[model samples]
Target chain A: MEREVNAYKCRKCGTLHYPFRMVCKNCRANDYFEFDIEPLPKRGKLLTFTFIHNLPAQFEVARLGLGIVELENGIRVTGQVDIEDPTLGMDVVGNVEVVRHDTYDDRYGFVFRAA
Target chain B: MRDVYIIGIGITTFTRLEYPLSEIAAYASMGALKDAGVTDVDYVLVANMGSARINNQSALASAVVDTLSLTPAGAVRIENGPASGASAIKEGFMAVASGMHDTVLVVGAERMREVNNLEATDFVATLTHPMAEYIYGVTLPGHAAMFTRLYMEKYGVTERHLAMVGVKNQNNAMLNKDAHLHQKITMDGILDSPEAFTNNPWVAEPIRFFDCCPVSDGGAALILASKEVAEASGKPMIRITGIGQATDTLAVHERPEPTDLMAVRIAAQRAYEMAGITAADIDVAELHDAFTILEIAESEEVGFFEKGTGHLALERGETAIDGKMPINPSGGLKGKGHPVGATGVAQVHEIVVQLRGDAGERQVKDARTGLACNFGGFGNNVVVSTYARED
Candidate 1:
């Protein structure tokens, strides 16, 4: 089973927030509706990226590529980017993928690739 | 409110301390008490982060008070992420300024070296938003790297400008006996030479190894008193003139603009307004430079230079010890070391030393006014303070 990326829209302000927010930062509304964004375009523009060489000793990789992606819906999310030479303003696509396998379980999250 | 002054200050060497956490706080507190020539204080405030998580100890203030034999004096602990040190001083200042206490002791300490570097990194990462940032494995360096990349693209800052900051601060650290990084780093060694890539590898892209502060264990203390007690101490009167604190969105991505440190700007404006001073009035400053990029960004945010111009000022040598405005003359966290809880207090300790003409080689000449910015949680919580030498 693949995990899907999710976002919540504030009922009062019509603002979208990822990972779910309790209240609308813009409108101070307490109500929100869950929105499934699975069919939405996985394409996004890369704002910035980094090659993280030092990581907590959970996985065995020497380095990981991380970046912030601004989706077409204007919501930004941080995830692993599977590209070597990441440049500013590069178009990328997001997919639900397994990031790492810790001692206890296989951790899964969003990963981006060059579109 | 009454006037509050710092009568005494103390600090332990910024390095791997072998003693227990309580002992570290007590050592610095005893030095402060001896300096003030006072055997007892009306209250004690301990500033610490991760004492409970990293050291497996809670009620740290209670243990410290007993360790220093300062029993019967009110004791409390202040934890405000990386800004805990100055936050404690603010509490002490309020106690004295409110006339609730004539004398208050504030101590900031941390035992980060108790855990290894990976654990230490994870420990610090806890400050990030659990659901948004930390759940995705966003470390502080990773955040700084992304910020640096964006700042560079926006302001035309280059790798050379960042290296200059590293070179200047590490050289300054060589003069500070209490500083953590003693070795002087050069542009050729870290950036210019062919072997530089191997010598100074990237921990996070765009932010090399030298651009980051080392994890350290240390403690710092300050004695805050009212005018009467301050006068009796017979020491130079350094007034705690202004204090400003502000907060921003807990998640970095939630911010309107990732590049602008709005919290720092608001906090500094409040502090300057309270002090009745402008950026030009400050002779010296200690900025939170947990990463090299922060020093430049904070310099701009704090009004030292126009936005997108701090790196240019670095090119002009305007921020050196002998420049128009000397910043981080005590080497800052970049070189002085960051013990999380102790960094903010140590910044004030260096400023007080500069105001008293006690900083041996790194002193800014005739520094009458100083500012310290203690940034917490990647600009989520920030505290800005101003101090003036009152002769």
Candidate 2:
């Protein structure tokens, strides 16, 4: 089975990184490890946003919405958003849903939703 | 100090082709040699900015040398992000000027169309901090959009301002046979383009699809020779009066003002100091317009206009071919097509054409002095070169 996606906390700096990193940027240490993968908070506010009209075939269904959101932990992360209005400093949050399922390929990604 | 002169230049039409990267370099090199009237080249400097991302291959210089069958010639590849072409030119200029070689060839090429759009974007994101910016999915357009917002909010330059830049460059590109997107642009087309307007959509808040340069595959080359060799060859020479390079922090947040590209200013000042001339003395110029806002921002940074006035100057027709100071007569990166590494060398080629009064229809009238600027990775690295037509 494919591994579930989750945030990995830096052992040295307590910073959380999506995807993954070999080293913590803040502490400059090679101690990127997580004991238990916890679901990230799905509700937050939008820091800034852009409406991407032209996108690759995968993202063409709906215009791509790129946004930076402040997580409940005060961590700012950039991700895809499905919100209508992209006003600055708007409330946004992450949703634990498959953004797009490549049926033939079978891959999924996390996307953001306005709370 | 020994003097260096660029005697010849050549560029292939920017297009999507099935040719290998090395093959493209060979074609451009041969054209440059023909332009220089040289049978033997002492050294070759290769510039390719995105081969690794496009093909998962690196070390393009050796491939070029083997393809060209230039045995025992010194060969090196240079990378300065998008400014790879100008960076290679600087290396070749220094090599000849320092008496390391009598004649040197600088060629810049890239094949981005070979990859899919997502792959290309991913490749460019490698230029940023992998852990910080790339993981955040910060695309190049995002950076330009951020700059556009800052310029608009701070200087009152609007989307209309950027569109005007597109309109002028597209019109000029129509005159350039070598340009990639040669179709003329109207202000309405820029403002109301299907891909940029309400029906079309926006990419980043301020920048739209039309505001960006094309992902093109092309090659451009220039031959540099010592003053003695250039004069003895009996070929027309475009003197390289000065070349200066400077770098700033890579991250956008690190800068004091994201809208102002200070590296361009410092580099241009150094070039002017060496060439003993100011921006006003330049009759023609080719600036890296990877995005519309880049042209305006770099122009202001290079002291071509007062801050926030670059858009006004473009609207006033001061930057057209017939204007007092013509910029990007080659259609700029927007219209001429930007192949990353090829852009800087192409800029120099356009300057040579302008200085020799050989640009044909788009020639800047009485262009005696010309300047070219190329910036890499959102103004992090910059190269400024000055050229003069010797009487």
Candidate 3:
């Protein structure tokens, strides 16, 4: 099965949200678990990107490329950009991947690459 | 609401101090109390960020109050990310303005140097959205770098502009006796020299070493009182005429426009409205320039310049100590050092000193009105305060 990033859709308003929230931002009327899980678009345009040499201790690499991408549906998400050379508004594609590891478990998020 | 005035102010050197966190806080408070010629306050608010995590201390307010022997006064610890200091002051203002407390001692202190560099960065990053930004290994500098890229693209702000702010503030720190980075920095040495690359390497792309603030341990204290108490003290009436605070979305990606800091804009607007003054009325300002780019961005957001034109003003030497609009004359967070919790209060401390004409070398001439903007948590929360000195 192919892995994909998930976004939450408000059942009442059809408003999509990333990382899931208890209430719909648009409608503001949501009960517990009153949202549907929807897969986020893998294709997007890199809005802004940064190569950071300073990372948390968990990230052992010398430098990490990160960016905010505007998806095809107009939703923006922060993700790790694997593209060696990233330009603003450049087309990109992403997949659900392990971004970091805590003391015991791995965390999964979108990792983008040049399209 | 009744008016609130700053009767006394004190601060320890914004550098690493080999003292306990509570002592750091108490030391500053003592100076404030001495300056006010009062040994007691009706309340105490301690602002700190990393005492529990880095310094292995907790219930910080209790310790500080006890150390200062201001016991039995209502005490609370305020943790509002980097804006903790000003947030604490805001509460103090409310207490006094509402006639609940006659006098409130607000102290902003931090001991971030107790931990190593990576550890300090990690702790600060904890303020970011957990599942979204933090798990992805996002740090503040990382966020600033990404934001800087966008601002540069949209507003034409360059690396040179960022370096100019760095050089200006760091050199300004040389005049600030209590500032952290007292060493003088020049554009030539940091940017134009042959070995400038190594001298100012990129910590985050587009954010070089000089672009960021040093992690220091220090404290700043302010005593807020009513008009009666302030007038009785016989000091320059540095009244906090305007106070405004606003919060943005916790996740930066959630904002409608990534480049716009709606919180800062809204907060400053509210402050200007409350004070019944425009940006032009402000004679001096101390902005939260944790990063160099922030100085320029906030200058625009706080209505100092037209949007996208702050850097142009900087190039015209408009933000210098004697310029039309002086900014970060105390070196700001960039050079004075960012003791997290202490920064917001320290910014106000500089404004108070400036308004009173106590800042000898870096005083803005004939400064009567001043402003301080304390930003928190990647622009998610911010506080803007305006003050006036009535002689």
- The C-alpha TM-scores of every prediction are 0.96, 0.83, 0.99
In model 2, how large is the Cα lDDT of residue B215? 80
lDDT of 3 by residue, B218-304 (tens): 999999999999999997899999999999999998899988999999999999999999999999999999999899999999999
Q: Which stretches of model 2 miss by more than 4 angstroms?
A: A1-49, A53-115, B192-201
Taking the tens digit of each residue's C-alpha lDDT, what string does model 3 give over A5-75? 78999999899998678998889974899999999999999999899898878898999999999999988
Q: Specify the highest-DockQ model's number.
A: 3
Better of 1 and 3 by DockQ: 3
lDDT of 3 at B131: 89
Candidate 1 on B209-268: residue-level lDDT in tens?
999999999999999999999998999999998999999987787677889899899999
Clashes per model (N, Cα, C within 3 A): 0, 8, 0
Residue pairs with backbone overlap in model 3: none
On DockQ, the stronger of 2 and 3 is 3
**Of candidates 3 and 2, the better by TM-score:** 3
DockQ, structure candidate 3: 0.87
Question: Which digits, one per residue and each the tens of the lDDT, describe model 2 over residues B139-209?
Answer: 78877776687677778888888888888887889999989997776766657656447532466667876
